[model samples]
Target: MYAVYLFSITWAIVQSLPQGAPPSVCQTLMPFHGGGIRPQGGLSPYTIVPRRQGNHIVVTMTSALGIPFQGFLLQGRTPDRDIIGQFDSSSVNEGHPLDCGTPSDSITHNSPNDKNSIDVVWSPPRGYEGPVIFNATIAQEYETFWVGLESDPVHVTKRGANDPQFSFPLHNNGPTPPNYIPRQVKQNSAEFDPFYQGCSVTKLCFGSPANCVESKNCKAAVAVTVAGDKYDFELKAESSAVWVGVGLSEDDKMGDDSVVECVKRGNGIAAFMSYTNGNPNYGAPRLPNPQLGIQLLNSSIQDGAIYCRVRRDALTIVNGKAFDLIGKKYNLLIAAGSSLKQSSVGFHDLTYLASAQSQALADVSALAAKSKLLIRLHGCFMIAAWLGTASVGILLARYYRQTWMGRQILGKDVWFAWHRIFMLLTWALTIAAFVLIFVELKAWSGERNPHAILGTITTILCFIQPIGAYFRPHPGTAKRPIFNWLHWSIGNAAHILAIVTLFFAVKLTKAELPDFVDWILVAYVVLHVISHLILSLMNCIADRSSERRVTSFPMKDLGGPGRNSAYSDRSSDAPYSNFRRGLLAVYIVIILAIVIALIVITALAPIAESWTSFKSAVAPTNAN
Candidate 1:
C-alpha cells in the first residue's frame, strides 16, 4: 500500500509538464506550477524572428545570449490579438500542434529538453491580407519562463482580384448573366463617363465638397446602386492613395461598421471587406469570410486615380452579425489614405468625409456632407490654449519676474498678476477643449492614437496645477523650496506635453488638419527654443555683470538719491533693460502670429479648399 501511494504521487508530478504545456495554457502562456512560482520579470532570454516569404512567413525562435530554453509555445497572431494561421507540419521541429480548440492555431514543444532553436512555417488563410505577427512563450525550465514575447510585424498584401491566388475563379466562370453590368470602367475615360453618369439621379453619389461628382473633380468618392437583392459599389480615389474604402455606419464613427476597401498593390487593385469594431489598434478588421458577401467586378489604376467595382449581397454577415442594406439607412463614410496601420486602415488624412445624416442606402439622391464644426472648434480651442495663453504664462513666470519686481497691480506683483491671469485662461480653455472632444466622440478614444492618451494626461496635469498653487506653502517656510520645485516641474511638464500632443493631433483623422500642420508645430518648437536660449543668455549676462561690478564705495547709498534711482527698477534702468523690452515685444508679436495662423488653419481645415476659393476669386479679376 505504501509503495503504490508513493508511485501515484510521483506520477502526478511527472504528468504536470513532462511532455509539454497543456492546452489550458494556450492563451495565458503560463506554466502550470502548483508551487505558486511565477514567471520571471523583464525581457525573456529567448527571441523570435519572423521573415515573410511570399504567401508564407517563417518564424524562428532561439535562445538569447546562448541561454538554451527547454520548452515553448508558439502561435501566429493578428492585430486583433487573435491566434490564426496554421503552422506547417513539414517544417516544424521538436514541436507539434497543441490543438488549442482552434486546430493548428498553436504549437508546443514535444518534450522538456534544452533546445537551441525551432523554426516553423505558417500560412495564413486566403483574404486575411493585413498583417501577421508571431507570438511565443519560452521556458528555461518549469519555473523560469517568459510569456507573451512577440515578433516584429509582417504585412501581407492581397493578390489582385483577377489573379489565380484570389478568392474568385481565375477565369470567367460562365457566360455573363443578363443582369451583369460592364466589368471594367477606365478612370477618367473619354469614351464614357460611367461612374458619374447617374450621379444624384439613378445612383447615390457620395464624396467631399458636396458637388465633386457633378463637377467631375473628386479625389475620392463612392457611388452606390441597389439592384433586386444586391448592391453595386463603385469606389474611386486619387492614385496617390494606396487604398480607398467606404463604410456603412449608423453614425459618423467607425465602430461596428462594415468597411469595404480597394487596396492598390503592385500594378493591380485588390478588394477587401473588414469589420472595424472601434478599437483601431486591436479590432478585427480582418474578420474574414469576405467571399461569401462580395463579388469583385473589376478594378483598375489609371489616369491618376484608382477605381474598383463590386457587387455585394444585400443581406450579409460580418463578425457574426447580420447587416442588411436593402432598405436600412446608414451614413456613408468615404475615406482614402496612403498607408495601412497593420490590420486597421491608416488615418484618412487625405479624405474623411461622412454623410450629414443616416439615410436610405438605396436613396438615389444627393447626400449632404457632415459639418466639421465641433472638430474645428476643438482644434481652435486647443491652439488658443497651449500655443497662445500657455506660452505667455510660461514666459512671464520664467523671465519677467525679475524685470517687473517693483511694479504691482491689484495688490499683486505685476509679473505674477499677469502670469496668474494667463495661466487661468489656459486652464479654462484646456478644460473647455477637453469637454468638446468628449462631446464629439462621446466615448474614450482607442489606444492606437497616442494623441488621445497624451492629451488627456496634459489636461489632467493642467487641472492639478491651480489646485496645487492654491494650497502652496508660504514663502521661506520649510517646504517652500520643495513646493517651488514641484510647481516648476509640473508646469514645465504640462507645457512640453501640450506641445507634443498638438504635434500628434495633426495625424488624427477627425482633426482634418493638413500635413503642413506638422511643419507649423516644428516651426513653433524651433522659435520657442531660440527665444528661450536668447533670454537665458541675456539673464546670464545681466547676473554676471551685476556680480562683477566692484562697489567703489559701499556707503554710496547714503551719499546720493541717484544711487537708488540707478538700480531701483530692473524694468527701467538695470543692465540692457531697453533691449530686453524690445525682445519681449518682438516675442509677443511672433508668438501671436504663429498661434493665430494655426487657429485659422484649424478653422478652415484641409487648407486646400480655402486656397481654391482664393484662386477662384482671383482668376475672374485676372480675366477682366
Candidate 2:
C-alpha cells in the first residue's frame, strides 16, 4: 500500500511539469515609429514573443528601454478573417469584443523584479486550434506611443508554434483615434457590449461645462465598432445647444455629401438630423427634406462634462439617398452656441478620419500643412502692412515735415502725399487679409476672445483715421491747434493699438510661424525703439539751442526784435540737421529691409517648400 501511494505521487508530479518540452519561444523586438500632426515625444519600443506554458498559449511584451507605460493591448484572430478588416473594427480602449476570443487579461505591467517586460496570456476559443494573426499597440501616459503589426503575421498554432518566424515591422498608421470617449452600453439591454478596440479621433475645447461657455470649449469623439458598419460619437460642452456631425468628404468645408448630426440642449433634450448637401458653400441651406436613422442613445452630465452618445449606420440607404461610409475617409464637424435657437450655419472645429487604416489618412496631414502656410502668410503680411509701413509713414511726418530739405526737395504738399499713399496701402492690405481669413474659415462664432476684440478695435481705428482726416481744419485757422492735437492723438493711438494687435497675432499663431519669426519681430521692435529715442534727443537739442540764442540777444530794438533777429529765430526753429536727417533715413531703410526679409522667409520660400513636400508625401497613387 505504501509503495502504491509513492508511485501515484510521482505520477502527479510528472503530469504537473510543462508538457511538450516548453515549446520553442519566438521573439521579435521592434522599435516604435509613426507620429501625428501634433508635436509629441519619447515614444517607447515594444518586444513581442509567443510561447507555451503548461497547456495555455501566451504572448509576452517587453519594453526595450525599461520605461513606465499605461498599458499594452494584444489582439489576435483566426487566419480566415480579413486581417485588415478585423483591425479596423476592433475596439481599442474599452468594451473589446469576444469575436476574436478575449485575452485572459487585456493589460499587464512589468514584474516587480523586472521593470522592462510584461506578459499577457490569451486563451484560444474552445475547440479552436492553430494559425492565428495578431497585432499589438502600446500606450504611454500623456506622451506619444506606437502601434505595430507583424509585417507578415506570425501564425501561432495550438502547441505555441508559429510560421514565418516573428518579424514585427513598424507600420505607419497615421493618427490613432482618440481614446477619451467612454464606451457606452444600454442599461439592461441584450445587445452585445460594443468594442472600443478600433482607432478613434476626437476634437475638444476647454471650459466649465456647468456654465454656458464659448464654442471653443466644446469636444467631440468618433469611433467605429467591432461590427465595422456602426459608428459611435460623443459630444460634450457647456452650451444651450450643441451640434455634432460627420460629413461624407475629408474636407470640412461643407459640400454635396451626406451629413449625420445630433443636437443636444442644456435641458437634456436631444434630436438627430440628417441632410444631403445641395451646395458646397456653408451658408447655403440644406436640401428641403431631412433624412433619418441617426439615433441618440444616452446622455448625462458629470464633473462639468456634458456627455452624450449617438450611433448610426456607417453605410445605408435612406430617403433614396445613399450614404456610403465603409472603407472611405471623411471629416467631422462640431458647432455649439449659448443660445438654444442658434442656426446650424457654423462649426466650431473640424477633424479628419478614415474608415480604415489606409493612405487616405494622409489627406488630413496635407491639408494641415496647407493651412499652416496660409496662417503664416497672413500674419507676415499684416505685420508688414500695418506695423512696418505705418511706422515709416509716421516717422516721415514727424521728423521730416518741417526740415528745410523736406520743403525744398519735395515741396510743401509732397510729405502729406507720401503719408496718404502709405496709409492707403495699409488699408488695402488690411482689407485683403480680413477677406482672406473669413473666406478660409467660411463660418464665424459670436463668442469673442481677447484677440478677436482687439482685432476689431484696430480695424475700427484704421477706418476712423481716414475719416477724421477728411474733416481736418486748415492750417493757420483759429481751430488749427485743436485739429493738430486731435489728429496727433488719434494717429498715435491707432499706431500703438496696431502694434499691440500684431504682437497678439504672433502669439496666437505661433504654431504656424517658423522658429525665426519670433527673433525677426524682436529685431524690428529693437530698431523701432532706438529710432524713436534718437529723434527725441535731436528735438531736445534743437529746442535748447533756440532758447540760448533768445536769452543772449534779448531783442534790444523796438518792435520786439529786428527782421534779422526774427530770421535767426525762424532758422533756429528747425528740429533736425543733416546728420539727424541722415540717421533717420538709415533707420527707415533698415526697417524696410527687415520687413521685406520677413516676407520672403515666412511666406514665399518656406511655404513653397512645405507645400511641395506635403503634396508629394500625401498625394495618393490612386483615388479611393
The lDDT for every candidate, in the order shown, is 0.72, 0.45
Query: Over the stretch 1-624, how does candidate 2's per-residue lDDT look in tens digits?
Result: 423433543343333221211111011111111111111222335555555454444555555556655434445544543222122212122213222223232332221122345454554444444465545545443123344432123443343343212223343333222221212334421112111111222211111111111212213333222112344454444333354454454454545555545455554536455443433333313334433655655454444334455556666665465755544655443334332234343433222221211212212221121233444556666777766778887776665543553343245444566777788777767666666655655555222335556766776777777787788765445565566666677777777777676655543422223556667777877888888778767766765865533221111211132313523433333545776668867987888888887776656533433554455446665343
Candidate 1 C-alpha error for residue 47, in Å: 58
Native-structure RMSD, model 1: 24.5
lDDT string for model 1 (41-149, tens) is 4555667777655556778788557778878888877787777878876686688877775778888888777888888887776666766767777777654566677
Residue 603, model 2: lDDT of 64
- The numbered model that scores best in TM-score is 1
RMSD each, Å: 24.5, 19.0
